[model samples]
Each structure stands twice: as C-alpha cells, then as structure tokens.
Target: MQAEGGLRERKKRETRAALAEAALRLALEKGPDHVTVEEIAEAADVSVRTFFNYFPHKEHAILGRNPEHLERALERMRTAPPEESPLTTMWFIVHDVLRDLENEGELSRRGELIMGSPNLLYQLMMASFDDERQLTAALAARMGEPESAVRPALIVSTAGAACRVAMELHKNAPGRPVRELVDEGFQLLAQGIDPAFGPNQSNQKGHS
Candidate 1:
C-alpha cells in the first residue's frame, strides 16, 4: 500500500513538472499573455481538467510555489547541530535551491524570458517576496520565536539580499557557478561591504 501511494505521488509530481515545462516553453515561444491553459495541457499530454487540478491558472503553471523545497530545507535546519549558525544554515538551503535550478538546462532560457517580460518579472518578484516570508517563518520557528521577531526577520532579509546579489551576478555568467557567487556575496557581508566592493574585487574575479 505504501509503495502504491508513493508511486501515485511520484506520477503526480511528474505530471506537474511536465505541465510546468510545457507552459514555460510555450510562454517563451509565444508571450505568456498569448498562451492558454488548454495549449499547455495539450503540450504536456494532459487534459485541461488535469491541468486545472494541478494549477489554477497558466501563471501558476509557470510560477509555481515550491513548498516541498522549503519543507526539506526546514527539516535540514531542524536536524542540524546547534553549532551551525543560522546564516550558514540559510546559505545551505539557498545553495541547494540554486543547485537544483542550475541542473535544469532550461533555467537560462527561462531567465532570459523573464528578463524580457516586465510583467513576468513583476510576477516573479512578487512570488520571490512570498518565498522570503515563508523562509522567515521557518527561520523563526527554528529560533523558537514569532515570524515577526526582529532577529529572524533581519537574518532572513540579509540572506535574501545575498541571494539576490549572487543570482544577479551569476545569471548571465555561464562559466561561474552560482554557489561561488553566493559564497562571494556572503564573504563580502562578513568582510565589511565597503572593502569587498572595491575595484580590486572586480579585477580579481573572472565573470564569464
């Protein structure tokens, strides 16, 4: 029974992935405004009803929330030894997410499409803010405080800023790993930002 249940869940995940990929590809080929849920469903070899079951709308298919990713990261933080700082734990979580995204060959293409579309960029940023809220809540839970607590809020916000800097710098640089850029951002934060942003820093690293 457990095996069957697992299989069923796996199939559902597969279907969702298929639909998401198809939706993004179509949005890239045709503008997101031009693509319909039916088209995305058909491309993924699923019925329109199935697509609705997976996602309420076409945008959800393209910009889906990754709750499972957050859950796994939180589980890791919960089990981590107390010696690890919250910043380090947060970096591990962020790095895992970047690694997962980098493994997808279509990530670069998706980034390009998002960059080209202002509306998509807005939607993406809003979704990102939502993710940050969720991350802050998890961090607070780990710290045994309310999500509104200043410490967790500041920590998560700083972490989010570091991630943004890393992602922006690494987005178009095909040769540099996102993790390296992320670590560099964190290092800058640790070493006083003014010194790290000096001209020497720019000359020291190969961007592409």
Candidate 2:
C-alpha cells in the first residue's frame, strides 16, 4: 500500500509539472494572454477537463509553480535546528533553494519573460506575496510565537525585498549567483539603515 501510494503521488506531481511546463512554453511562444486552457491541455497531452481538475484558471497553471519552491523552503526552515535564529534559518533555506535554481540555469529566460510582461509580472508578484504569507505563518508557528508577531512580518518583508533585488541584479549579471545579492541585501539590513530614511540619504540626513 505504501509503495502504491508513493507511485500515485509521484504520478500526480508529474502530471502537474507537465501542465505547468506546457502553459509556460505556450506563453513564451505566444504571449500569456493569447494562450488558452484547451491549448495548454492539448500540449500537456491531457483533456481540458483534466486541466481544470489541476488548476482553476490558465493563470494558475503558470503561477502555481512558484508555490512549490516556497513550500519546500518553508519546510526546511521549520525543520532547521532549534538553536538557529529565525532570520538565519529563513535566509539559509531561501538562499539554498535560489542557489540551486541558479545552478540549474532556470532563471534567465524565465526572468526575462516575466519582466517583459507587466501582466505576468503582476501575477507573479501576487503569487510571491501569497508565499510570503504562508512562510510567515509557518515560521511563527515553528518559533512558538503568536502569528501576529511583528518579527515574522519583518522577516517576510526583508526576504521579499531581497528576492526582488536579486531578480533585478540577475537581469544585469546573469552569471552571478542570486545568493550573493540576497547576502548583500541582508548585510545592508544588518548595518542599521534607519527605517525612517525612506531608503535615501536626504531623509536619513534630515535634509527635507
């Protein structure tokens, strides 16, 4: 029974991956707005009804892939040694996953495609925000703290900002690992940039 269950789970994962890959390929060839669910289903070699069974909308087919990595990172953070600081654990998990993606050569083309289309970028941002919420909740639970704790929110925002900056940096330095950008961003945070400064020296220096 255990072996059969594992096989079934693996098959389901493969089916979902096929659907997502098909959607992305079609969206790349012909802009995301032009791709239809039926076309995605055909490309994935599944019936349209089967596609709906896996995803509620065509956008879900493309955006759902983001959650898989986020979930895995969250699980890693949750299972890290109890002695690890929350920030350190979260950063470690996120950096490891992003580094692996960088090593796999999966970022350049997808990053360009996502950055080129405002609609797709907006969808991706929404998905990323959802990931932030989930990770925040999981981290709070793991740390035995109230879910409304400010620390979790700060952690999520910091991590999200780091990822956004990393993506922008990747556009210019495609050869550099994203972990470097993330590390640099965290270092800036650690150096005590005044929160009231609005990320500018004028605000920090009280010029206006």
Candidate 3:
C-alpha cells in the first residue's frame, strides 16, 4: 500500500508539472491573456477539472508556484539543526530550491514568460508577497517567537529582496550559475549592504 501510494503521489506531481509546462508553452506562443485553462488542459492531455485541481487560475499555472515545493522547503527549514541561524538555514533551503529550478531550462522559460507579460509580472509580484508573508510566519514558528514579532518579518523580507536581486542578475548573466549569484547576494548581506567596503569598493564608492 505504501508503494502504491507513493506511485500515486508521483503521478500527481507529474500531472501537475505537465499542466504547468503546457500553460507556459501556450502563454509563450499566444500571450497569457489569450490562453485558457481549458486549452492548457487539452494541451497537457488532462481535463479542465484536473487543471483546476492543480492551479486555481491560469496565472498560477504560468507562475508555476507549487505549494508542495514551498512546503518541502519549509520542512527543510523547520528540521534544520537548532544551532544553525535562521538566515543560514534559509540559504540552505533556497540553494536546494534554486538547484531544482536551474534544471531543464524551465526557470529561464518562466522568466521570459514573466518579462513578456505585464499582467503576469504584476501577478508574480503579488504571489511573491504572499510567499514572503508565509515565510515570515514560518521563520517566527521556527524561532519559537510570536508571529507578530518584527524580527522575523524583517529577516524574511530582506531575504526575499536578496533573492529577487539575485534572480534579476541571473537573468542578465545567463551563463553564470544562479546559485553563485545567490551566494554572492547573501555574502553581501552578511557583510552589511554598505558601499564603503567589499570587492567592488571603488564602484560602490562611486555610486555613493
């Protein structure tokens, strides 16, 4: 029964991936507004009901924000060694997630899709805000602090900003590994985001 259940879960994940990939391909071919859940389902060889089961709307399908992926990352963060700082644990979790995204060109395609659609870009920002809020609450729980505390909110929001900047940089430098960019972003954070120091001191001073 356990094996059977695992197989079923695997199949569900495959179906979800298929639907998301189909949605992105369609969006790329014929803009996000022109695509429909029914068309995506048809392309993925699933019914519209199945598409709805995986994603609430077409925008979500294109965005490809799987709740399972988020839960998996949260689980990793929750189970990290007690001695590890929350920020360190966050980098570990993000590293694994970004590694997966860097596979099979899907991340690049999704980035292109977002850049092409203003509405999709807006929706993606809103979704990111939701993710930030969720991570803030999770970080609070991990720290055994009240959810209303300001520290967790600041940490998670700052981390989100770092990730966003890394993503933008990665989009420009497509040949470089995204993990390296992310690491550089975190390292800069660790050194404080001041312009007076670091390898780009001259550049930073000029900007200042």
Candidate 4:
C-alpha cells in the first residue's frame, strides 16, 4: 500500500512538472497575455480539466508557486533542526530548487518572461510579498520570537534579495553555476558582511 501510494505521488509530481514546463515555454513563445489554458494543456498532453486540477490558472503554472509547494517549504523551515542557524537551514531548502531550476534552464527563461510582462511582474511581486510574510511567521514560531520581530523579517527578506541577485547573475552568465554565487552570498551574509570583509582582513580567496 505504501509503495503504491508513493508511486502515485511521484506520478502526480511528474505530471505537474510537465504542465509547468509547457506553460512557461508557451508563455515565452507567445506573449504571456496570448497563451491560453487549452494551449498549455495541449502542450503538456493533458486535458484542460487536468491542468485546472494542478493549477487554478495559467500564471500559477508558469510562475511555479502553487499553494502545496509553498506550504511544504514553510513547514520544512519551521521544523528545521534547533541546532541549525536559520540561514543554514534555509540554504539547504532553497539550494535544491535553485539547482533544479538551473539544470532545467528554467530560471533564465522565467526571469526573461516575468521582466517582459507587467502583469507577471506585479503578480510575482505580490506573491513574493505574501510568501515572505508567511515564511517570517513560520520562522518566528520556530525561533520562539514574536512574528513582528526584526530578526525573522530580516532573515527572510535578506534571503530573498540574495536569490534575486543569484538569478540575475545566472541569467547573465549561464556557464557559471548559480550555486557558487548563492553560496558566496550566504557566506558573506552568515559573516554579517563587514567583519569578514573588513579593510584589516586583506587576504582573499579566489572567486568560485
């Protein structure tokens, strides 16, 4: 029973990934406003009803921000080891997505599409803002701090800024793995940026 359940879940994930990839590819080929749900469904070899089963709308597939994934991410962060610092815990969770996106060339194309479409840009911004709030609350509870505390807010926001910079760099130079840059960003962040990079600390390691 457990094996059958696991296989069923895997098949669902595969179908979801196929739909998301098709949606984004079509959105890039046609303008974001021009693509239809039926077209995306056809591209994924699925019915319109199946597309709706995975996503309420076309934009959700294109942006890859479904509620299930978001909730799982927040839960992972919230239940992270007590001994691990928030940044360390976050890196493991986020790096998996970055690595997968980079492998699939998903990040660069999504970045391009989002920048070209005002509607997508605004939607992404609003969604990100909402996600940050939920993540902040989750992290706060894990840390035993009030949700309004500056530290939790800073952790989520700073991690977000680092991801944006990493994506831009990845888009510009596809050869360099995004993880190298993101790792550097987080390392600098873990050191609080000043002490490790102070004028007195002269010796430097070569860039990744």
Candidate 5:
C-alpha cells in the first residue's frame, strides 16, 4: 500500500508538471489570451477536468508555481539548525527552489513571456511581492522578532536580490551555472561589496 501510494503521488506530480509546461508553451506560441484550458489539456494529453484538478485557473498553470516546492523550502527553514544564520538558511532554501525551477527549464522563457504579456507581468510582480512577504514573516518568526524588524527584512531583500539577479544572468547566459552566479552574489553580500561602491567612497574610484 505504501508503494502504491508513493506511485500515485509521483503520477500526480508528473501530471502537474506536464500541464504547466503545456500551458506555458501554448501561451508563448499563441499568446496567453488565445490559449484555452481545453487546448492546454489536449497538449498535455489530459482531460479538462484533470487540468482543473491541478490548477484552479489557467494563469496559475502558466505561472507554474509549485506548492510542494514552496512547502519543502518552508519546512527546511522551520527545521533549520540552531547554529545556522538566517542568511545561510535562505541560501539553502533558494538553492532548492532554483534546482526545482532548473529541472522544469522554464526560467529562460519566463522573462520573454512576462515582457510580452502585460497581465502576466503584473501577476508576476504581485506574486513576487507575496512571496517576499511570506518569507519575511517566516524569517521573522524563526528569529523571534516581529515581522517589522529590519534585520529579517534586510536579509530577505539581500537574499532575494541575489536569487533574482542570478536567474536574470542565467537567462541571458544559459551556459553559466546558475548556482555559481548565485554563490558569487551571496559572497559579495557576506564580504561587503567593492569599496568604490560604498556610499562614503568617491564615485569615480572604480568600475566593476
């Protein structure tokens, strides 16, 4: 029964991934406005009912945010070792999220899709804001600080920027290992940026 249950869960994940990929591919090819749920279902070789079972709305399928992935990251953060600083915890969580996204291979096309669709752009922006809010709350709780605390907010912003810039750079240079780029970003955060970039330094001191 356990094996059977595991297989069932695996199939569900596969179906969800198929539907998301089909939705994005169709949206990119024919534009999101023109793509219908039925068409997406057909593209993924699933019934409309099955697509509805996986996603409540078509836009969600296109956006392809996996609840399971987010949950796993949250769980990791919640159970993180006492010695691990919030930033290190965030690094692992972000790496896990990136690994999942990289497996789906959607990050590269996401930029083009968002740029072409105004609605999607707005949806993406709102979704990012919500994600950050959730992470901030989680980090604040973990640190025994209020949500308004500046330390948690600052760390979340810095970590979030690292991941976003890494994704953007990876989208442009597909050959570069995204994890390496992300590491470089985090390293700069850990060991302060170039002195020239410091606010107190001369503006004309350097170019990086």
Candidate 6:
C-alpha cells in the first residue's frame, strides 16, 4: 500500500511538471494571450480535463513554481540546525535554489517572460509577498515563537528586499551569477545604511 501510494504521488508530480512546462513553452512561442487551455493540454500530451485537474487555469500553471519553491525552502529551514541563525539558513537555502534555476537555463527565459507580461509580473509580485508571509509564519512556528515576533518579520522583510535587489541586479548584469548579486546585497545591508545617509541629523530646516 505504501509503495503504491508513493508511485501515485510521483506520477502526479511528473504530470504537473509536464503541464507547467508545456504551458510555458506555448506562452513563449505564441505569446501568453494567444495560448488556449486545449493547446496547452495537447502540448503536455494530456486531455483538457486532465490539465484542469492539475491547474485551474493557464496562468496558474505558469505561476505555480513560486509556491513550490517556497515550500522547498521552508522544508530546508525546518531541517537546518538549531544553532544557525534564521537569516543565514534561509539565505543559504534560497541561494542554492536560485543557483539551480540558473544552472537549468530556465532563469533567464522565465525572468524575461514574467517581465514582458504585465499581468504575469503583477501575479508574481503578489505571490512573492504571500510567500514571504508564509515563510515568516513557518519560521515562527519552527522556533516555537509567536507569529508577531519582531525578529521573524524583520528577517522576512530584509530577505525579501535582498531578493528584489538581486533580481534587479540580475536584470542589469545578466552575465553575473545570482549568488554573487545576493551576496552583494547582503553585504550592503550588513554595512548599515548609516554610512550612506549619515547619522540621525537631518538637513531639513525647522523640522525638529
């Protein structure tokens, strides 16, 4: 019974991956607005009904990878040693995942496609914040702390900002590795903003 269940789960995952890949390929070839659900189903070698069973719509197929990536990152964070700081553990795991995306030759294409489509870009941005909230909650639970913990929120927000910065850097420096961009962002954060902005003094007159 266990073996059969495992096999069934594996098959479902494979089918889902196939469907997502097919949708992305069709979108890239014909433009996202031109592709139909039936066409995506045909590209994945599945029926329209089967495609719907895996993904409710074409956009979901394209955007589902983000939640999947976040889940994997959460799993890594859960298993990491207790001695590791949450930020460090998350950074290491996320960096590895981004590196894998780069090595698969999918990052550039995926990034370009998302950036080109306003709808897709909006969807991704919303999903990213949702993932950040989920990660923060998961980390709080794993640490046996309350979700309202300031540290968790700070870590999540800072990490998210770093990711955004890294993505922008990647857009400008396509030849550079994502890890390098991430490291540079973290380094800047570590150096503190005070050096760039000066201390607490303000230049505004009559503001105090």
Top lDDT model = 5
lDDT of 6 at 20: 82
What TM-score, computed on C-alpha atoms, does each candidate reach? 0.81, 0.81, 0.86, 0.81, 0.80, 0.83
Query: How do the residues 118-185 of candidate 6 rate in per-residue lDDT, one tens digit apiece?
Result: 88878777777888788888888877889999888777778778876777677778898667888877
Deviation from native of the Cα of residue 186 in model 1, angstroms: 2.3
Query: Looking at model 2, which ten-residue stretch has the lowest summed lDDT?
Result: 100-109
What is the lDDT for 34 in model 3?
Answer: 98
- Whole-model alpha-carbon lDDT for candidate 6: 0.78
* Candidate 5 C-alpha lDDT tens digits along 25-128: 99999999899999999999999999999988788789886788668867887899999999898899888887787777876686557656778766766766
Colliding residue pairs in candidate 1: none
The list of candidate 4 runs beyond 4 A from truth reads 66-68, 103-105, 193-208
| Alpha carbon lDDT at 46, candidate 3 | 96
TM-score comparison, 1 vs 5, better candidate: 1
* Residue 128 in model 6: lDDT: 73
Model 6: worst 10 consecutive residues (lDDT sum)? 198-207
lDDT for every model? Answer: 0.77, 0.78, 0.82, 0.82, 0.83, 0.78
Each candidate's number of clashing pairs is: 0, 0, 0, 0, 0, 0
lDDT of 6 at 94: 73
Candidate 3 residue lDDT tens string, 51-84? 9899989999988878876788778867889999
Which candidate model has the greater lDDT, 3 or 6? 3
| Between candidates 1 and 3, the lDDT winner | 3
Which candidate leads the pack in TM-score?
Answer: 3
Looking at model 4, the pairs that clash are: none
